[model samples]
Target: MKITSIKLPGDISDESLEALGNDLENNSSTLDIEIPLNELQSSLELNNQQKDLAGQISNKAPRVIYSTSPSILVVIDGEPKIQQNAKWGVEAVVNTPFTLVKSGGSYYLHGGKHWYVAPSAKGPFSMTTTVSSQLRKIEEQSKAEASSENDAAEKDENTIYKIIVSTQPAELIQTNGEAKFASLENTGLLYVSNSSDDIFMDVDSQNYYVLISGRWYHSKTLSGNWEYAASDRLPDDFAKIPEGSPKDHVLASIAGTDAATDALQEAAVPQTAKVDRKSTQAEVTYDGEPQFQDIDGTELDYAVNTPASVIRWRGRYYSVDNGVWFESGRATGPWVVSVNRPYAVALIPPSYPVYHMKYVYIYDVSPDYVYMGYTPGYLNTFVYGPTVVYGTGYYYRPWFGTHYYARPYTWGFNVRYNPWIGWGIGYHYSSGWFNAGFGIGHRPWGYWSGGWWGPRSYRPAYCWSPNRYGGSYYGRNTVYYNRSRNYNIVNRNYSGNIYRNRGGIVSRDYRRADFNNDRYRNNRNPSWSANRSNNRYNDNRYSDNRNDNRNSRYN
Candidate 1:
């Protein structure tokens, strides 16, 4: 028997979900059904690779394990699961959306690990709630485009890409209405937010995954939990990891003190540089050991983009920590950088089955994806896209009960899950690596993938054209001088960002002057600099670069 949609009702906490956990061979609410006859007969023969390991994971009924416990851990358990092309040990569809679900009070979990699922994208971001879903997708946009117009358009300084949860998913919640729910998985791990007493956010203990250039590298933890050290921790020997030919084995290595940390060690990563990337802790070694070994020269002064100076938006600044849109100076803070991040988006886990709602961010908007926060273990459960409510969250190890009917829109690509922590989708180049197009898997392979060496430079010439609306808010249909159809405007007055299809312009000087020299050198305004050296800046348009993957973290 095939299962369609199953909804449970209650004031469930994430902790209860964790109690039941992933391997549900015992007491719990389960949706057991017979596999469809046609699907059973249609099971295709496995290739040599999967066939060799079939015995190890060979049960045939593809099942998605949802825990009702607060340790909300979601996954696809049992033998013979249908997920064949998972990049990380988990399995699920690629490029889809999920919603967050919430109700009762905040959810709770006791020990073990819990995963939550949000029903929409707008989020139910209360720390009191359980963690939720993740969205994954496979895209087919060609890595490189044939267009070779040596002369690109000049940029304006008013281009900005405001990244909030998509209105589409937000609308889903408004229309479908919200649901105070529970999961089918009985008694699983769940995590409850702190009760009336405020729990001090775990600055270091919370776990996170950071991906750079497609290659995933985890941080070294002194304890099982993260220490959240500034870049100053690296020894002076840090430098760039040399490019190794594909024939050479790189990406996954146990480099002693030799790995180059310059990119991460020497210079401070520019604010503009981190615009479209993700990073996570790799392996947990040297636990409880002194992590900072003073090579004397190894440690140096690192840079910090405080919530104070670094936070800006429109022509104003807003404190994102509390999600308040108040202008800068309105709320001053050296907001703690705990496991939680500022604007980059967050997600709930799928492993757990308890309710209430889960919150996460849309790090990559293209395929539309968000990774569940405070990742525990990389279990066999893969994330299946979410059902929208407030936002979307995918299921962990989704049951292969959904029909395999090919959608009218199909991306002919495959998912490859490796034990290695880093894995993502992107269009490819003749060269042997990938680029973290935008969000989702923010990092790419550093070697042959030719990781972005430094922060991208987007000046005035790359600013975007104003959207058809406006004229009321800013008092003009379009900023004057930028009337010319130039594509170089990069308005980063807020967080330093280099966005695509950016629009608008506000620089009077840029609008009037010839973008051909270096007379303008305002460290504050990057567009002014690009407007002068129109030569180098125009030559490298962001959209021009060849990003192989769908460019969407979740589609």
Candidate 2:
């Protein structure tokens, strides 16, 4: 369905729009997003009040106004090390002596103030400096050690070599061997046998290694000189692998390693990484113009408005609240926190990214260490802009869209009328009434003294009753306002309704009705009914009284 107009509160600011646009532009390389100047301007105008409401909402603790991708952690030498892989350019282990630099599309590792170059991951390393002096001396002296002997045969007691895992794409190194090792579907870790198999190899920035044949063997390259490793010599990070991880299988295969593995696992798992599977279920409510699309090969319908907060896709209900995502099988959900967000979330149709881009989380790194995966076929089908292309789920589009309905008070802004633009001058909130102000004149008494009707008139019109609980009474082809609390009285025609504009929305409330409808069953006001059998003078007098009361109230 097309949304004709949207009414926003007056609090949203132009500055928020500018900042959002700037963020999108700055991250354009990683997130393939381009916001046309006109679109930005329009969104700013439409959501002018969002900024003011954001501050009010954010004051509540635990409310997240914005969210960034979660940090990635890779265990090294029995300790968990944070990894920064923003934009997927280079994965660098944080807070370590080692750093990675990219030149001409090739990555070089800098460790202990020395540059180690490798053509592809599998490398016979040669120490060289194609870089400047500042970087050459960029070493931490305390952490730095002298270069090791070139010959593999030579061993030094003082030289301690930490096993570095490779971050390069994992390959099926051995296919027909006694045991098969294949890359897991989403994680970079290699699965030794099957999904359930405990044996796995963790990937790091410079090396990929697995505990194989009861020995810790890691390679800087994909294929390796599977060097023998002493259990005590292994880096503390290696022990940080999770209980079910392929790295854990190393402990299972070897004796007396379980105790160490357990300790590392405890330290490896971050508090944030723990998924809260239980979540209180809430009804999914749509607040904006929801565009409905069918899920491929499913009877389910998916609805999205710009910055979609609620999504129904693939017969499942999904929603994002306060940066955490929840999912359920039904629209009215007993939701569970989604540990592994499904691929369907990333494929939430082009309309979502085109409008509500900020809520999009397709390329975010989840607690699972893998980037939230997307369907490459879906990305290929939807085009964000001419130059922006998401190739094979490797890229993402930056979040855009105004926070028009971002606040809790404004969360359920759904109205039946045109949502994109204003419905001609019948008080802004009148749009919520079904077919409000359409085809009908603003005159509660019908064509009064040559007043213009419908869209042609600029004069303020009264077409809806603001009382949400009030009922609309139809008699002799005319509509009357009936208040629930005062059933003894009825508003003849629409004259009792008061219209006032707040923000862009119009609110209508009815004055107390003095005349009882039951008493005037036979002689009801002519304006309240099509039949004018009642005396005109009596009707005119009542009309005069109502008009005087309305004028006095406004005055």
List ranges where model 1 is wrong by over 4 Å.
1-243, 247-259, 265-267, 271-424, 428-555
> Which window of ten consecutive residues has the lowest lDDT sum in model 1?
168-177
Specify the highest-lDDT model's number: 2
- The whole-model lDDT of each prediction reads 0.19, 0.29
Question: What C-alpha RMSD separates each model from the true structure?
Answer: 30.3, 32.8
Could you give me the TM-score of model 2 versus the true structure?
0.20
Residue 187 CA error for candidate 2 (Å)?
A: 34
Collision count of model 1: 182
Model 2: residue 188 alpha-carbon error in angstroms: 34
Candidate 1, residues 272-382, lDDT tens digits: the string is: 111111221111111122112111211111112120112222222222211111122222322222121222111112212111111111121212112111110111111
Give stretches of model 2 more than 4 Å off: 1-99, 103-107, 118-124, 133-323, 326-555
Score candidate 1 by lDDT. 0.19
lDDT per residue, candidate 2, 1-555, as tens digits? Answer: 222222122222345544556775677668655777865674554334333322121111111111111111111111223343332234432212224433444444543324555553223334565855433443332122221111111122122222133222111222123434655434556544522112345555445454321224455543444453445555545444344332332332232354333222221111111222332222333333445555443233544332234556545666643233556776545665543333333223332221121222322223332111111111121121111111111111211122111111100111111101111111111211111111111222111111111011112222232222112221111222334432111112222111121011112221111233321244321112111121111111111111211322211
